[model samples]
Target: MIELKSAGEISAMREAGRVVAGVHAAVRAQAAVGVSLRELDQVARTVIHEGGAGSSFLGYHPSFGATPYPGVICTSVNGVMLHGLPTPYRLRDGDLLSVDCAVHVDGWHADGTVSFVVGAARAEDLDLIRVADATLAAGIAAAVPGARMGDVGHAMSAVGRGAGYGMQNDFGGHGIGREMHESPFVPNEGRKGRGLWLRPGLVIAIEPSLIAGGGDDYHMASDGWSVCTGDGSRSAHVEHTVAITQDGPVILTVP
Candidate 1:
């Protein structure tokens, strides 16, 4: 069932979101050419620990997962779309990297993701990241009270489609509260007037992951965790945790 959060509960969740944002900030600052993915993960770990927040990704073994997740954050590089495991591989100039993170503070959870270039950036890669960021903003704008979930999805998908990008069919954002994953799976594409009605106190993560080659096909990596594009094309992912309130849609995951 979908659980509505109270004012106080939402406040607590904002705290968790702050920690998630901090992790993203630290990861972004530390990610560069010559940096190993494992080192970036450690940066996130330090931020989470110092914030007194627990990682939502570590030890998480979802039904589709082959084993418990071993990192505090997912490090997706270039063709790696999602669930990319951190490794000893050092980043190279012009590499596209996406970091996904989640955290819980005082039992409330928040999740978010960001994509960027390691050092030197290609024009196409910058364009891909721009579209992904735009889609995420569109999704958040559609999260106001009384709107339908499909409105949010439609808003996001329209941007990606217009940019000639494709999204993963099986993976998208989800309801987040005390648990990292909750009821009411949120899709990236849908009819504007369809799906669940958005009510005040409703909280959800809005993430848009776009494939530059305009294909939806992807395959798992040998590590049983990383998801890479089937066509070897690059991708970008961005996200935010938003809450619907009487005033408007409030983004909880901000630094």
Candidate 2:
């Protein structure tokens, strides 16, 4: 079932999204080299609590996973793609970290992800991160009413492929409202004219993931949480929660 929010409810979701974005910004600021991944998660926990919001990931257990998530935020480093459980591993120079977060405020949920380079970034690393960001932007641009879900996927895939990066389609975005993950799974790659039609008040997250080695295959990490590239290549992911409004797509996870 696709859930649509009212104008007033959408306003509240946007507010929740602002808090999530703020949390991401705070985590990024504290993610310097030598900082442990657990430290970053602590920053996220603090920001969410300080913002008077509940974490969408705390103790979250999905059918696909064996155990409930144990951290407040996901910390995917280099080879890891998604579902990276925050651990005591300390970051180092040139480590590419992707932080994924979601928060629930007043019964509404908003999710977003941001990728960052810890120290000096390699040339290709910079390109991979840029591609992920651009891919997310393209997907958001295609979130207008009258546009099919495939349009967003295709746009995101084009950005990744054009930059010579491998795109990951196993995990993508989804419709978000009262819950973090709702109905109507939104893939990162799709044909241009299929799937559910866009309507106002429908909020969703559009995430684009790319690997540096140009290989699309991935493997599940032994931790049973993180997903990494099969060839041990670095990866980057970018995401944003947006709503299809009368004024095109409104990026709720931004100011």
Candidate 3:
């Protein structure tokens, strides 16, 4: 069921959003060449702990995953698409790091993601990241009240397809509130005016996952969580949990 948040509940979720956003900001500052994904996870864990909030991601066991997740944050580097578990693998020059983070504060939750190049930015990688960011912005723009859910995906598709990039629909966005994943699945491509009707209080994570190649074909890693690109091409992802309101879409996961 699609549950709407009360005003007080929305306030609580904003707190969670800020906490997750802080984690992203801290991790962004610490990410650099030679830094291991494990080290970055530690950084996020420290922030989550000091903030007095529990991790919504830790021990999260979805039916598709082989086992419960073990990290506080996702560290998808380079060819890895998403759900990349933190590991001893160190970031190298020109590596594109995609970090997905979530946090729960006072029983509410917020989620967000960011992608960036560590040391030297390759032209192609930079382009893909830029497109993903723009795609996310477009998706957010299409989240106004009364807009069809498919409009959001259609907007995102315009950006990715315009850049000749491949869009990933297998792992798309979803309604987020008490849990990390919820109802009203939001795909990356769809016909406008074709999906659920947008209404006030409906909060959903609008994530744009794009690949550099022609297809978003990917496979899970041995870790049972890491999903990587099948063609070994670099990818980028950007997300923000947004809420439909009488005025417009309100982005919760912002610092």
Q: Which numbered prediction scores highest in lDDT against the true structure?
A: 1
Deviation from native of the Cα of residue 186 in model 2, angstroms: 0.8
lDDT of 1 by residue, 1-255 (tens): 999999999999999999999999999999888999999999999999999999999999987788899999999999999999989989999999999999999899999999999888999999999999999999888888888999999999999988999888578899999899997788888789999999998889888899999999999988889988989999998989888999989999998
The digit string of per-residue lDDT tens for model 3 on 109-207 reads 899999999998989888899999999999999998888999999999998989999888989999999887889898888799989999888999999
For residue 225, model 1's alpha carbon misses the true position, in angstroms, by: 1.2
Alpha carbon lDDT of each predicted model: 0.92, 0.89, 0.90
Pairs that clash in candidate 3: none
Query: Model 2: per-residue lDDT, tens digit, 190-231?
Result: 898987888888899988889999889998888888999988
Candidate 2 TM-score over all chains jointly? 0.98
What CA root-mean-square deviation does each model show from the true structure?
0.8, 0.9, 0.9
**What is candidate 2's CA lDDT for residue 209?**
88
In terms of lDDT, model 1 sits at 0.92
Error of 1 at 231 (Å): 1.1
